[model samples]
Target: MTDAVLKIENLQTYYGKSHILHGVSMEVAEGEIVTLLGRNGAGKTTTLRSLSGLTPPREGRIEIFGNDTTRWPAYRIARLGVGYVPEGRRIFPNLTVLENLAVPMTRPGPWTVDKVLELFPNLGTRRDSWGRQLSGGEQEMLAIARALLVNPKLLLLDEPSQGLAPLLVREVFRVVASMREQGISILLVEQNARFGLEVADRVYVLNDGQMIHSGPARELAKDEERVRALAGVGGKEDGVLTAKPKTSAA
Candidate 1:
């Protein structure tokens, strides 16, 4: 991997009085896809929040594009070319799809509303549809498209495959994989360990708010015993990793 596009060291975050992440540390290299995997409540989402400055870490160092942005405000971080698509697809419920796309005051880059619409033709066809009218998969697509309009060099995605059908999961992963070719680095938090491993160049496994494993995704994918110990055993139905997360801040 090239020099890191995003890096963190000793990241500690909290939710009011509850400490969620304990010295979590990781990185996403330039143009590489890195997946952060763990069972529910493993502080995966909190990690993304810390990186995006949504929930700034209580203690840590965060470097994006070589600038130390650990305590920068969220808007300042976004302007530095970091796009974050949070856990829920938080589009404006009453707005039209086209209206939603027009919301971001993006940095100058190759991604435009028309360009993203061309990438997601289904959305293009439903340009005038209200956000609440779209299906779950469509909403997910819209969220990702809107993130792209920020012209991000690094994208932080949280649980993108959640609540979608199997086919849609595959399609979403396909699009995510293509982003690397377009010179975008990704830090992906996914519960679908199967698809997460499939697309990632490298992997980071979180357990109890700490990083337990970090290595090439292929190495982790081929070792089922290690995967079981680190991320829990895989389900027989869809091969998803299922572990009982500790009762802590998720």
Candidate 2:
């Protein structure tokens, strides 16, 4: 238990024709809520894909739960107790809530069907409901519950709040915070900077597939300009994005 839950060094990834990620290094401590903050097309999702072995890094080191699984296949990495909830809540449209969770059942962690239902009571009420019948928030809860059922040591959630309503967004973060209290290491990639920082212990800012800044998440909230620049906030409405570098993170 003396190792970081998830660690990456100089992680680089490619998407076919061009290289995406540069030298990116970061770590998530056990039971800590860490976040990767960036805008659209900023390589945030690509980073998660790389870590999960979905988009294997061309050059880098990825260690999950103290094991060097860089060269391992996706199934191999997944079986090692790492759960990934992708950006879209990819639920089985025809399956019920319980059925969806049962799809990836590994079981060993502190999570159980009853406990997960308790965590999100609405799920219990909708157990027999089809995935397509639930609201966006309900679908998100189902995704988290399904991941928990796998008994993951580390959870990688990509844009959990994307396209959710304001209230549902708050609910999502609250759930994340509660998960941290229960000792889950979370790597969250979020476009909503305020929501991400609110629940994260540490935050990393990635630009053009390279990490530019990382520190206590609170420090990020204090610097409006820095947040605006690296995080894709405060950009004009021309849709022609320009890089506006600011002071580096200390």
Candidate 3:
């Protein structure tokens, strides 16, 4: 409890009549990179959404630094230091990179506009460019930089490498690793099991709205068969994550 930046217990959430999360529970400890891994429809994003109050849980508890925030609104959750970078790189397209970074400044401490620009040098060069003009990788960087501007204690990242090239994916994961080095706790929801394993200290797998596996990332990374089976991927070999072949529906 003392070291945990975010904690959830028996969390349940729904989207209209569709049940999304069922008794999902996990914790992100201070300065830890905890990845939530699963296949396409495994409720990984829902878990992060639930944590950030984007889709409030119908049942269970959410605590931020020991304070219960289950029923808090999204804005309130953000104020409580829960920064969420959603599935899409949802930066304001019409706004400049600098403006997008300035929009989330509530009560910032160490994360200033200049500091974030320095952290993301590419963004610094493109500060005056409209968000829509940036490339996919740059957009992803901007999304993360915008969240960091909030000076959050817990950062929620959903699919940061979803549509990136291999080189860009590596770069994105490197930034994620760097964030952990800076003492920022992160709850990353990713479909890329291999990439997630590379940066995560701890890993949890979610399936059909429930957490199926939880342990050290390295432990799971070593067991290729188990990772393939759990995450529906071809498994990592020679430091690369090969995609699993798709099968016809029976």
Candidate number of the best TM-score: 1
Ranking by lDDT: 1, 3, 2
Measured against the true structure, the TM-scores of the candidates, in listed sequence, are 0.93, 0.89, 0.92
Q: How many collisions between residues are there in candidate 2? A: 0
The ten-residue window of minimal lDDT in model 1 covers 240-249
Between candidates 1 and 2, the lDDT winner: 1
Regions of candidate 1 where Cα sits further than 4 Å from its true position: 233-250
lDDT per residue as tens, model 2, 1-250: 2569898999878988789999789999999989898767789999999989898999999999889988888878878888889878898999999898788857577888888899899999999999999998899999988888877878899888776777777888888888777777999988777777778889999888888889999888777677778787532331112211222222
Q: What is residue 142's positional error in candidate 2, in angstroms?
A: 0.6
The residue pairs that clash in candidate 1, if any, are: none
Best by lDDT: 1
Error of 2 at 230 (Å): 1.5
Score residue 133 of candidate 3 by CA lDDT.
Answer: 98
Q: Which RMSD values do the candidates have, in order? A: 3.1, 5.7, 2.8
Give one digit per residue, the lDDT tens place, for model 3 in 1-250. Answer: 4788888999999999999899999988899999998877789888888878889999999999888999988888898887889988898999999899879955657888888888889999999999999998899999998898888888899988877778888888888888877788999987777888878999999999999999999999888889878877535541233322122232
**Model 3 TM-score, all chains together:** 0.92
* Native-referenced Cα lDDT, model 2: 0.82
The superposed Cα distance between candidate 1 and the true structure at residue 8, in angstroms, equals: 0.3
